[model samples]
Target: MKTLKSRPSAILFSCRARRGVLARGLNTTREIAMPEYLSPGVYVEEVDAGTQRIPGISTSIDRARWQSLVAEFKKTVVPQAPAWTDSNDTDPGVTLLELFAWLTENLLYRAHDIPERGRNAALRAATALSVLGHRCTTECATLTRAHFFAGQLLDAATLQAEQDYHREKLRRHNRMLHGFGIVSGLGVHVEATSDPGGGRVIVDPGYAIDRCGEEIAVCTGATLAFPSVGNEAFVSLRFWEHPCPPDSPSASGEPDVTRVEEACVIGFAQAVSPPALALARLIRADGGWRVDPAFVPPRAGAVMA
Candidate 1:
């Protein structure tokens, strides 16, 4: 099926020690044992969306526009779509405003050039996809915020319309994609990632489906594989971590371990310093993702939960 709405997935929560300090023997020891790093610093491991910084004013404007988009979307768009589908719906339960807000935040305010202007064409060209998962802190602050938001800047109507347009497009084309696996030449905008062994993806409207043999792989908020079961396809998912930030250097000249978890530290090949573990955790949380600490950087700093 076409990519579905992102739902809650593997997530790590940041819970502070009630006392904030471990006593001599740490009397009240109760291992709640949530998904966490067996590393030095107390951290929660997760997969999350990446964030891009903009000017202060620009951020303010972007937030304002997002508010407007949500309002308009709740009024105009959301009313039309259902939350989900038995097979998948022509309309979505998520709002155009929400999608646009993400695009504004993550897409860095990029717009599509009417690649095909229709559902069929858009799907053929879209190799990547996204989904909407939740760990919504619902808090205004970005701290401990796990969600989908990573990209550049955006303008007024241009950004909203662009997001709105794709969201609607995703709604329109989802059913078709769910039925047939990958479709090339169908024009849809996706962010091509430099990840090895991952599909070249595009994220707008929150999802995309790629055909891999008998499996119809889905990409949106997370990556999943669906085995085509007769006329229908059953989905299996795999998530990817957002890339390490460009500016922040994690590896030292000789390769200093960034954020060490219970597992690995250096990329077997790159050794060029990946994202700091702290940063990686934040990104994963943004997407409400799951992490296998084995693949993460080795632990460093303080003991985590």
Candidate 2:
């Protein structure tokens, strides 16, 4: 079974990347327990393409600026020491710490030519602002829209809907956008099997409803993983994507997947951070704020590469 800390489509990126890993000493881990502490709420898995057990994969994504933003935001917003004694330590979401962390990350200053990762981070952070019920201003919306592919994809009706949703987020989102100069009103939809009996229910990405009616993207995490015959597993993970269902609202009370419905909300919360910071940092204006020291990674669960 191949081991990868990356999401399903993760690690499995490139065969050549794996060809060199065997020489990188990871080849031996295949014989033992899995690797540890890569990202919070995230974990690497060992996969096999039949004869080959423990095969690792590496792949290329849209190369959005969000990647850089996450790296930078992680380096800055997250903490070295636990925010509070007895913090979950594993998931790290005690208090509004994540919220403050979000604010702190948005305060970071970058260069004029934002990297793709940075662009993604900026967009994600803006999205978070909205989730926190922060509104988006014209400037903030424009700044965020500059790099947000989803926003650009909107038609006049959709655009108007988005703007209306922004206003609905407590106050007008434009205020948060302009006042804080950051992205706001980010929302995520988690869709469990509308019908769980379909064998392995496919919680298709961005397939759920966003009741907020905002232009929130969907970022998924491992709800349930299926073990393979070769002792390997196929875990599902979702990346940030366009909001097609603007008027859709997530089902209330419980997610269709009983186990998933019972799963902690932290799991879903953890999925947003990386994608959020990535989008925020992507198109954030340069030389705007003071740069803080890098934040240490979270202790467990959500693992990064």
Candidate 3:
């Protein structure tokens, strides 16, 4: 009998000689069942290796997965196609990948909420997706409109008005329910002089919550003229939100004026005692500028909410 040894990594098999012929014969099989032997002396054998275990490919979809796929494409395909070097989100390939990711996420959400139904389900899904940083598509927008307004068709102006109304409502709720006052550092100090006209009251830099629940940041100290004698005046911090011209131009000489959201002013209400919203009160008698006995300067770093 001639003995043959297969490669070390392959399964070992032996064939014995009987009546001048090999007792066991080699048979052809599927490619995966056994590796083919092409060498002249190589022999094939059928071995029942049981069930083959094939590893599963990942089908998980997520933002990270999409990002990794983009990275892999950039690594493998960019070299072959030099013209497609741009890997930014603006790139068509990257944008398509993002859209795919969004669709996958949306489908996964629907699958997770398979039992959900009706317009409320659509609205909830749209709101949840929006919270997840997905922009509302036309269908989502329609669903949201139907849910909120009983399917009323809103024009641009009407939509803006509705938005403004809700915003003001929220603001009022915060201002009234939460209570507002000088949160810190709006101390009133009178620079007294023999002539009331020459005197001034300085308001230190401070932060406050106005009646509108809007935060007032006094970046720098402010000064207001002293009230005339025999008159009472109260200092109020007012907040206004409007667009103002930019203070300077950009280095590129382009116009950089943007609308400012918050504009605050230190104002005075004369002949009126300090109201609940007043930061300080000025009582001017025959004496130059008298601090009202009832007036207490807001303590530094004290919250008056």
Candidate 4:
């Protein structure tokens, strides 16, 4: 006696009298598995060609292109091919094509997302990133203005002692910088030493150095106000120096300018020597100087010391 064989899997979705009859259409949401028939003896349901076609610019065109290529090649180039059975995970060629398609799809996605504005926002951002120089100010008028907190009273002797301590700190900081091969007092930028009287210590570093020119402006802008009639005043400034003005035509041509926040006194009277601080012209390094309070001189310096 002969027995009946099970129908092909594709017939389940295509035929209405198989699983469709069993579920009675109540669970119509259930997914129907479809199989691809390869040989003449195999039977499979016909698939809608339109279902495989991707829509819109956001869709994966590269994958569609690869599939079309494979289908056309199978039909026209190798009509009788038997080794090419299925496009599955086991096929190395299919995997490679899929990888290539994914990368191409990503490129196409980014291209599609580019903004349609008149001015290129991306180009502007890239240009801003290439700037080499920057300027800033702390709005300090005089050294005394930065010190001496209101309501925090100190005797004249005590105030004098505090001032002396700050000056000494500046001297030591400068000396450390000198030992590091930054000879000129001008090369060192110092911050305002903290005062014990609870006044906010303000260190104002002001300097404008241009890469194209060797000129360095210590303190720019006119004086806001002078110290009280008879008393003397101090002005502190700090800044970082670059090797030279950038003059290249490449993307990295921007000079790396550094600014420091330190204090010093520039006395109006020729009578007193400028506060015991020294400054020298910014020397050129191969790359540039690094901003470090405890910077030690090395055997050789590159873009940074």
Best TM-score among the predictions, by candidate number = 3
Ranking by lDDT: 3, 4, 2, 1
The RMSD of every model to the true structure, in order and in angstroms, is 24.4, 22.5, 36.1, 36.8
RMSD of 1: 24.4
- Against the unseen true structure, what C-alpha lDDT does each candidate score? 0.24, 0.26, 0.43, 0.27
Tens-digit per-residue lDDT, 76-127, candidate 1: 4344564421233334544565677677556443542222223222222111
Candidate 2, TM-score vs. the true structure?
0.20
Which 10 residues in a row give candidate 1 its minimum summed lDDT?
21-30
The better-scoring model by TM-score among 1 and 2 is: 2
Clashes of each: 51, 74, 0, 15
Model with the higher TM-score, candidate 1 or 4: 1
Candidate 1 vs candidate 4: which has greater lDDT? 4
Cα displacement (Å) at residue 180, model 1: 6.5
**Model 3 / residue 270 / CA error / Å:** 2.5
| Candidate 4 per-residue C-alpha lDDT over 1-305 given as tens digits, one digit per residue, 9 for 90 to 100 | 01101111111111211111100011011111122332332222222212222121121122222333334345443435656755579788989988998986697578874333311332232212212122222232234312566797777667667765565444344333332221222333222223221111122223321211112233321111121123222222212221111234336643332221121122122132211222221211232221233433221112132
The superposed Cα distance between candidate 3 and the true structure at residue 140, in angstroms, equals 27
- For candidate 1, what is the TM-score? 0.18
Ranking by TM-score: 3, 2, 1, 4
- Identify the runs in model 2 with alpha carbons over 4 angstroms from their true place: 1-56, 59-199, 203-208, 215-239, 242-305
For model 3, how does the per-residue alpha-carbon lDDT over 82-133 read when each residue is reduced to its tens digit? Answer: 6776648668788888899799769868886323233223323322222222
Cα distance off (Å), candidate 2, residue 196: 19
